[model samples]
Target: MNDEIGRRLREAAEAHQPDRDRMLARVHRGMAGTAVPRRSSGIARSWPKVVLAGSAAAGILAVAGLAVAGSVQTTPAHPDSETTLTVPSPSETPATHSPGTTGGTPPPAPGHPNRTTTARPPAGTPTPAAPAGRRVSEGPLSAQGAIDPHSTVYWAQATLTLDVAEPLTAFTVEVRVTQNGGVQSTGQWQTGPAGDFTVTAQESDGAVVYRWELKPGRTVPAARHTFAVQYNHTAGARNADADGYRVQATASDGIHTVQGGFTPAG
Candidate 1:
């Protein structure tokens, strides 16, 4: 029994010897001031991985927020699919007209004929009347004049006196002589007189005709004969009844005809 007990005790001491040695080595290392390595726990080993995963998630969230903000800034506030925009052409503008004028007619285009515009006359305007013909003389001859007849054995002579207030440029005279209740002769004369007398006798319409014309600046003073004429008989012989001789004379100033007559005593 004692021998067996000793063997068991020895075995137990052998087992405890390794533990003691390990404890002594730790104590020595502490005294020498050397670092001791520690065994890591499961939570400590996985801590770095957890931190990386959380950082990645935060980065993803930040990127997504930046994208959303950019989209909001660029997009239209009131976007609609049916909206439309238009631009005008240069030729579509309107034209302007002048003032104080009715928009009657537009100007003609280039390379085309120009159009004429007529103005309208005012209302209630009257047209002019034509001049009259056959006016009477307003002269001194109309107030005073005479024709006298005289007889010779074979011829008859007559004298004419005309008084005028204005200048005369032309004149005509017609005379008829009668004796013994019968027509003897008729005469007409036309001449240009310049302080002189022109006597002429001819036959027309079965009677004698005479005419005369006065020059420029031929005027009569008040109550004076400025024109005179003496006509000689050239038609034929005179009648025996000298007391029965009569003379009719007509004178004109182109616009009027005046008449006077007288009988002569032998």
Candidate 2:
């Protein structure tokens, strides 16, 4: 039986001829079918279309990512139009307007002034009255007369100023105050030495005549001299308009004589 089986196996092996090329082709097809699936005919023929579709999908995804990034970069969180506030400095502020000030400039402080003012005496205070008439000049002597402002309502003084241009060998000054209402000589004086002059005051010819004569041998140098005659008057402002003075002097040049009247005063 073993011999018969061996002969039958040998006969069967010899009868089936070994086709090596067909067997190799069969093995390659089996390996392709099991390890890697065989593509369909339509898939193999449209491979370019499949690859194109995949590339188009990747481009769309890249474009979408770029668009998202561009939106994030371009879009602003806040609006373009913004509000700005401006504050004024203290110096730029406008000044308040005031009366008597021009162009908005403030006026000088109170009790302060840009210009000076002439001070004047208060009301009821006495002011010296200026001479009413022109000065009297004769030869080397000139005389001006005015009423003393220091006089009151009941008393007054007549003043005489003498400008002597040369030394006087003889000099005599007389002030006559007319008795406007009630006038009487109270006293008399001179700017020269009292001992060098002889003063005599008396009422004569409806007036109080005050005379000052240089004493004998007494010299009066070239200078200015003042002579005043004080008197009592009525209980009101005295009318010195009628009052007059006379100055006579004998100098080296010649005899000088000047006469003038005082201004009215109280």
Off by over 4 Å in 2: 1-135
Residue 209, candidate 2: Cα error in Å is: 0.5
Work out how many backbone clashes candidate 2 has.
0
Local accuracy of candidate 2 as per-residue lDDT tens digits, 217-240: 999988998877776666555567
Compared with the true structure, the alpha-carbon lDDT of candidate 1 equals: 0.37
Model 1 TM:
0.29
In terms of lDDT, the poorest run of 10 residues in model 2 is 109-118
Q: Give per-residue lDDT, candidate 2, residue 54.
A: 53
Per-residue lDDT value at 91 in model 2: 82
| Residue-level error in angstroms, candidate 1, position 9 | 99
